[model samples]
Structures are given as C-alpha cells and as structure tokens.
Target: MTFQSSSKPQAFAPLSAESMAGGVYGWLTPYLIALAKQNAHIHSRLLHLTRTELHFIALCLALMGEKRDDADHFGAFARDYDRLPRRSLLANYIDTAGPGYSPKLATLVSKLAGRPWRMRSYLRLGELYAEPHARKTLCHLASISRWHLIALSRLPAPYRTYGVLRKIRKRYDLACVMFGIEVVRRVRTDMTDRQIIASLERSDTSRIRDWVEAHYERLPFPTAPTGALTDGTGAVSRPVATARDLFRAAREFDNCVDRYLWEALTGRSCFYRCDNGQRRIAVAELKRLPGVGWAVDEIRGPNNAELSGPERAQVFAMFREAGVLPAPQALSRFSWFDLE
Candidate 1:
C-alpha cells in the first residue's frame, strides 16, 4: 500500500463484534495515542516480549483502559483493586486482548516503558482489568504499574471533577462506587503457607475476634534459620475483620503451599509464575485449612511434602474415592454471597 500526505484518512476493517466481546476501538484507539508518544527502543522492546509476556502486557492495557478522567468519575478507581468483573465477562475480554485476534497487545505493552496514560483511555480498560488473567497476574511487574496509578494520579492534582470526589487526595467517586463491583483486597506479604496455616491452627480461638486474628502462614524455617520472630517474616497474627478475611487467609495459605510444591516439582504455577506475588491460590487449598475442614486438591501430585511417599498415594486414593472435597458446614454458615 502507498500513501501520500494528502490521501484521505483511512479506516481499518471495522472491529469484529465477536472478536470485540472485550471492547474494540475503545481499547485500541487510546493505545494508538499512547504509542505515538513513545520513543522507538522502548516500543520495540515491548513488541518483542514472549507470548506469555504479551498476555501480561495486554492485561495492563485492559486494566488501564477503564480509568475515569471525566469530571464525574475522575480518578475514582485509584486504590481500587478488587473490582474485577464476573469470570465469564473477563474471559470474553481476554479473547479480545489475546494475540490470536488483537495484534496490538504487544505494541501497547512495548510502550509502557515510555508513555503516560490519559483517563479517558481507561473506560474499556476497566472491563479488561476485570478479566481473570489480568486479575490472576495483577502482581506481575507488567501488571503492577497499572495498579500504581494510585501513586501516579497523585501528580495531576486538584484531582477534582464532577460526580466523583477525591479522598485523602485519591480520586473517589461516591456514585461510581454505588454500583461498582470492585472487590477491594488486602495485600499480605512474605510468610509461607505451612507457616500461616500452622499459626492459625495453633493459636487460641476462644474470642471470635482473637480467633480470626491468628496467623496461618508458618514461614519456611530458614535452612540456616533466622531467629526472625520464628514467624518467618515477622508477620504475626492479626485480627480478621470479615468472612473475606478468613477466606483470603485460607486462599493465601493454599496458594503458598501449592506454589511452593509446584516450583519444587514442576517449576511453575498452573499457568503463571509460582511466585507471581499476589500469590493468589486455588480454592481447593481450603480443604485442609485446619479448622475449615475441606479437601479440594483431590487432584493429587507425585510429591506432596506434607504427605510422605506412601501417604501421598493413600490420600489421593481417598480423594479420588471421595471425588471433590467439600467445604465445611461452618464455611456454609457464612454466606459467600455477602461478606457481612
């Protein structure tokens, strides 16, 4: 194809609606504006990342796409991490952002090292951010920047607008949050699962408040051993405030154990990195949650340290005979539908 400065503007093939279940021009158009501002090297670097790396980048794009810049919801999503959409909607968007269809994912990520994003570009970014792959990997180096918008938005101050209000200087709109489904999560660091779960199981649970406050992770006893509180990272138990809190603890414990095992055995978590840091775990990990009493990992692997060689075979056989592990009656006592 040949072009001249005077040539009439062109329209690429219209974004396919099926391919666009993730949102089309709403995502790509803004990215083009972002791409225009980048220097070549950075752009090329992002363009050259691996397929997995490319998916991570697109996750960022989908995330940053929903930012609210208009006077109404300006800066509202700041610090808002848990607002992921339903699993089905996000899967659709991933299909949209995934490489087989949207070739621009690489291009957009390559520019991350160079460009600054505008708020409007985020409308679709919100939907993409809700995508599960994006949610699962939100802790990746590529994914982390999108979350850092809380700190970055601090720059374009006055940070004021219509509909939304700034809180402690963060863009916080009451209206958007009224219907916002974002699930605000707690960020826990360090401390391994055996460490966390052991802590929880050992602690006193007489007081409901105190019971929830126990630490479940047990920090790998340092091979050389650090006297660091014997709690590994010095994070002792703290009070759990909601059902989500217990659930989060259970989830993290499961993830830490599974991830540690996977790395020791397979060198990776299901599809992402074992240490991908948000360190999100599968729900099955909740089975042996000490007090929780469910056994989800009925899938069984060759080497489970918690279980010896013979024990592994036995437990898995039992798991197969039992089929899927069931959540405890106590777990049912709490409504997952409502955290309160």
Candidate 2:
C-alpha cells in the first residue's frame, strides 16, 4: 500500500492525527463558511453545528470509515475521537435526522454513537445535509422527475456556486432515473465500473418521468444542507471564468453528488471497505501526464491521510500542464472579493 514512483518509492512527510484533521478542515472550511453566509436563516436556524465542527466530523467519519479494522496507526485516532465531545454532537444530528426527531431518532442516535459507525449511511446522511444543494436535491428526489429534470436542464452551466451545481446534479439524477435506475441505488454503496459507464447513455425520459411520478411521493420539506455558498448577490465571489475554474467546479460538483460517477469511473467504488473515495476524485482531476500514473497510485495507496505538499504540487503541476490551472503570477491579477 506504499506509493512508488516509476523508478523508486517516494519519501513522504509523516502525518499525525491532528495535522490530518487540520488539513481536511482547511480544505473544507471556506466552502462551509461561504455556504453558511449565503443562506443566513438556514445557517442560523434548524442546524446548530458550526462549520468547523461539521467539517471536522465529516473528515473524522471519512477517515474512520476508510481505516476501519486496520489495527495500525489510524486506530489511535479513532480511539481518541471516540472520547471527544464532538462524537456525541455528530450523533445528536444523526438522531435528529432519523425516522423522527424525538425518541425514535434519539434512540437511534444514542445506539449509533455508543459505538463506531460501520456503514456509510449515517455518514452519507450527514454529508447530504452539509452541502448547499441538500434541500433542493432532496425535494427533487422526492418529487416528479419530469418537471424537475426539465427545470434543471434549463439552468446555465459553468456553475459558479453550490446552488447552480445542485441543479446540474439533479438533472443527472433524473437522467439516471430515466434509465430505470433508482436514485438510492446509484449512490449509497459500492458500484461497478460498468454501471458507472452505462450512466452516460441516453434513455427514455418521458417514460422514466411517468414511472417516478407514480412511484415517489414528494417530501414534506426541503432537507437543508449543513453548508452552502453565498446567495450570489455578493461583492465577494468565486467565478469560473477560466479552465482552472471549470475543472475545480467539476471536481466540486462531483463531490456534491458523492459516490456516483467519480467513484465508479475511478474504480474507488469497487472497494468500499478499503477505499477513501475522495482520493480517486482528486487524482481523476489530474491532467494526463508522464508522472500521473504514479501520482494516482500514490493517492490511492494506504496512509489515507491528506495529500502532502509535494503530492499536491505534483497534482497542480498536472493541471497547469493541461491548461486547467493558470500560473501563480496569473492568479494575482483577480480580485475574488471586495473590501466592503
């Protein structure tokens, strides 16, 4: 499970538990903050977790799941996390989202938090609510497919925020439904590469819509996500005006859907117990290059911690080579946010 370059094994900086947690938080915090600010009421109401704690929980869950049963180094982190107040906080949210908010969910969360989570269901549930699109996507999932797909298709691309990307993913979900595939089946588990590729094919949209409308009932309310981007009417903005921006958007969009196309296409979905799904998604974004094969292997290997600086630099270099990431000098010219 060690990473090897073509000629030899590459040396990597060792990862400590705290540093790993910090790495994940840094990557996710800004996105969560932006999302919280965009939907002020939703951020203030309904959810009680802060963006930092939410992000930390997700990273911890992903890490725990990825390293489960390995009696090695990661076991220590898992043991340490079990004792944290944060563990119960995550459990509380899950209980709230369960079959009912009270005793049912309360009972469920209590039972679940009493031990380490085994399956990704609870984790997935938490993640679904963490993104900006959680509400809209859940509504689409529970509603008529025909109207939802049509509306989503009408939305513009080069998606600038989580809201826009959610729309695109809804259309994708509809397309899968049109092919006689159920929304839950396409996600929430290990899927084969064949199933993944087949998703690209066209299907009978009208027939699928009819079936969905008849079979599924609309949900009671929008399932608000744990995080989101700004409401888009802000002076501070992140625009996808360049190839780098688009590539990054695509990565984030794939992330929003979680364990669908990116997982399957990259072969990460096939190894549910052993896989840390995000690595493959990141590697898949790397441009075709001389050293990329090795890079991908390194990313997919054990250790399963955050990418080291050299590894990140290598990935970025590939993007630069592919013309998706601009040079450092080029990035300084843009004003991403206003002072006001």
- Output the number of the lDDT-best candidate: 2
Segments of candidate 2 deviating more than 4 angstroms = 1-62, 69-82, 87-130, 135-340
lDDT of each: 0.30, 0.32
lDDT of 1 by residue, 75-104 (tens): 122111124332322333334533332323
Q: For model 2, how does the per-residue alpha-carbon lDDT over 1-340 read when each residue is reduced to its tens digit?
A: 1211232212222344544433233433333333333334323531456434453544343434434323342333333443546545344333343332121211223222222222344444334334334424434342322333243333222111233323235445544443433442344135453342233233234444433232222211112111111222221112122223333433544432222233323333211111123433232221112332211212221223344555445444443343443233212323232211
- Clash totals for all candidate models: 25, 5
| C-alpha root-mean-square deviation, candidate 1 | 22.9
Candidate 1 TM-score to native: 0.17
Regions more than 4 Å wrong, model 1:
1-176, 180-307, 325-340
Candidate 2, overall lDDT? Answer: 0.32
Residue 52 alpha-carbon offset, candidate 2, angstroms: 22
